[model samples]
Target: MRLALTSDNIAGACEAVVAEMIKAAQGEAMPYGGDPLTEQVTKMFAELFECDVAVFLVSTGTAANVLSLAALTPPWGSVLCHPESHIVNDECSAPEFYTNGARLVGVAGEEAKISVSALEQAINKRMGDVHSVQPSAVSLSQVTEIGSVYSLAELQEISQLAHSKGLKVHMDGARFANALVSLGCTPAQMTWQSGIDIVSFGATKNGAMAAEAIVVFDKNLAQKLALLRKRGGHLHSKMRLLSAQMLGYLSDDVWLNNARHANAMMALLQKGMASIAGVEIIAPAQANMLFCRLPVGMAEALLAQGFSFYTGRWEEGVVRFVTSFQTQQADVEDFIACARDLSTSHTKTS
Candidate 1:
């Protein structure tokens, strides 16, 4: 009856990764992503993306994102992104710091998806002037800060618009697999084929214990990431630990399976939540995240009963519940039951 759907399960790196890690420890391998497994994973990425991709593994999504942005933007330039984007808000200005003082400008849009007009405005508002930060790149989140996703057309529109402005495109794909499943598109179509120049290909949020990657679609931007990752202090000496997690995450299509389960659970919960009075679905029930509103007292009562979800960060009474590979139908049911019970009580009293 414990439903604490806040983030992905870090229950010791999933089964497949654990096996890979144990094998990695049993023998010698190159350090700093020069090992056989790293090479093989690189091939996996290239094949998965349907192009010659330059891949770099990191231990955290923030590192993957900041390092990639640093390579794409000069210190004097700026990156335009959704106001709630991880780079703009959550990463503690790491993108700006990593890029040595590049500016992070917010692009306003609905559902945290930046619109083409907003991009045009953000880019033109002092871009390429000697007195202000130049627009060097743009960053987008696949499964946006809210639950909604960018459609293929949305991605193409933004990417094409950014490129025409001489800005490279980067995607914060922390929920890459979840969005991929939701959109039913190939990785290539979701990214490079749609004009994405770089991607922070995330696995930790799906099933990996601690693994994320920067995938370079524009092959020319490849070399600098290695040095940037090392300088940023994410170059693991035992590189195979990170490599093993990604390898296993990609194997048997576990990443997609995990995401599919999470997304399915989100869909189920959204459907059930609609019937609960006073519970408002605040955002589109897309991917594995949901935004909804509950009465303040009911929220407190649910948390007191050990049903946990994010609250009070974005706004009062509105919260986000995230499903992961470990989230269960029973958990969802119990949560809904608790919320419904509290809602009933609150209504009767009011």
Candidate 2:
């Protein structure tokens, strides 16, 4: 079997999502988010968060993220985020384009998470400077790029600081469910309760086909964001399809269950990798994603065995393994066994 640990979205749609999509296809309904399914999805999200929220469905996380940022910031404003944040490193400047040239200021921090002090410094750096972009918002990634999840206290501290500085807080929740399950907190507690103004609630990475939500906690931004989403050409006409995926993802706690399973698989992988000689865990594996360094030969051996993962993105020997709802335990065990064998052979040969 070719084991793939590349990313969750690569695993394809989950069974429930497929079923929901089929059901959606069988019925004709209103378009442009005027359908009942879309309305239900909005209510479902509001219920999930334990507060009234405006949920706008989009086909991609990038759309969800950039539109949310655009709603929070102005052309002359900037968004403060960690240097390794998806908006800064992975989005290919879509944020800048959506915000009409708003700057993304990278704040230095460890493990892909922005510390309150670092964010404060970044925000204060250009305050009232006409030559510099004013910090208007702060973006945080739940289950950060390096797999480190911010504690509720950490989130609260950062949100409080940003709000005190007149900055809106946005969460790029591409792995929201994973981080939520890891933190063992309610969705509301992780977001609005922590002072987050908006969230790019991602389902594609978790289990859905291509459903991502721009969940607005700050009701004031909802109308403006709806307009921005349309202007950005992200408002899907067959919106029920997107809404159905979210409906299925949320039904019977499928989202949470999927995240728990993925996290469990990652914990098993982390444990196995820890025992392999010359493998170094480079970050805190708090969610389904893990970053580690492997001996070149061991990595090559694993690849030879048809096990696939990301490598050399962060550094020379560092690799990333992302577990998904569909990741099989057997594949994980096989990978570990192969790595152990390779490590042993290399040690003996040397």
Candidate 3:
């Protein structure tokens, strides 16, 4: 039936998370994240990270990222990140707004994973120059925009570089679970233990109703993040609902399971696509995303078949197919079949 290959938000909430929210709604709990559930969820996150991390819940990934950057950077500072990163491109100045005028300096990277060299150059270009903003933070995406995953070693190299240059590292982990599941690495291995200072742990895109957490590894930055999230108007009055979503998502490793399924679907889609005619993969299918170029006719036919995905500005022949936790294997097969049929029809017509 209805196949969604647009974004992870198309996925519905997990039953456990839904039940937790319903249960939370039945109680007379304190508001503004002072409730027991919120406290318990934060504790769970801390334990998961294997450190006393500060966890702040937000309604969206953008809020989690922008608010975390606000806590890390000052008004006059800047954040160094890949040119195609969500924080630099998707946030639409949310980082700047939350940071009271901090700017983002984009580094050159193909898959939105900041290379140590590119980061160093980007930060160096802004240094020893009063006219330019000072580099205060470096942000990287775990599962990059081009569907590439950063290895733990790569993250360590980038993190060590940022810290050596007196900058903190922030990770826009919108597809964190996808990357983590693929890497088969613990959260701590990809983060704090590897020099990450904060992470925007995304849940809405996975299976939660609407939830994201800003994880601050450094305790000193915790108070500032709390104040910033409150001032940014992200402090939910009925914060237990958000907490419930996160708690249930992480309760029995549902988050990892969901991500694993999504990644598997992407892999299947990628394999099916590679066998088709006139279809080329633009990037490696490392996580839940598949960036590829299809024949103009096949792209148009797929669009006509109720298959929805980005055409990347309606170019002559290119598209982006995004898989999610809810993307079914049958849907992937149907889409591949559609592409095959379209290619055959186009050949006959031509």
Question: Which has the greatest TM-score?
Answer: 2
lDDT of 3: 0.88
Best by lDDT: 2
Q: What are the Cα lDDT values of the candidates? A: 0.89, 0.92, 0.88
lDDT of 1 by residue, 111-203 (tens): 999979989998988875799999999999999989899999999999999999899999999999999999999999999999999999989
lDDT of 3 at 82: 85
Model 1 spans with C-alpha error above 4 angstroms: 9-12
| Candidate 1 vs 3: which has more lDDT | 1
Error of 3 at 7 (Å): 0.8
* C-alpha RMSD of each candidate structure in angstroms: 1.3, 0.8, 1.3
TM-scores for every candidate against the unseen true structure = 0.97, 0.99, 0.97
Instruction: For candidate 2, write residues 1-350 as lDDT tens digits.
Output: 57799888788889999999999999689899999999999999999999999999999999999999999999999999998999998899999999999999988788888977888888888699999899999999998999999999999999999999999999999999999999999999999999999999999999999999999998999899989988999989999999999999999999999999999999999999988999999995999999999987777778788889987677889999999999999989988988898999899999
Query: In what order do the candidates fall by TM-score, top score first?
Result: 2, 1, 3
- Note the residue pairs that clash in candidate 2: none
Ranking by lDDT: 2, 1, 3
- Runs in model 3 with CA error above 4 Å? 314-316
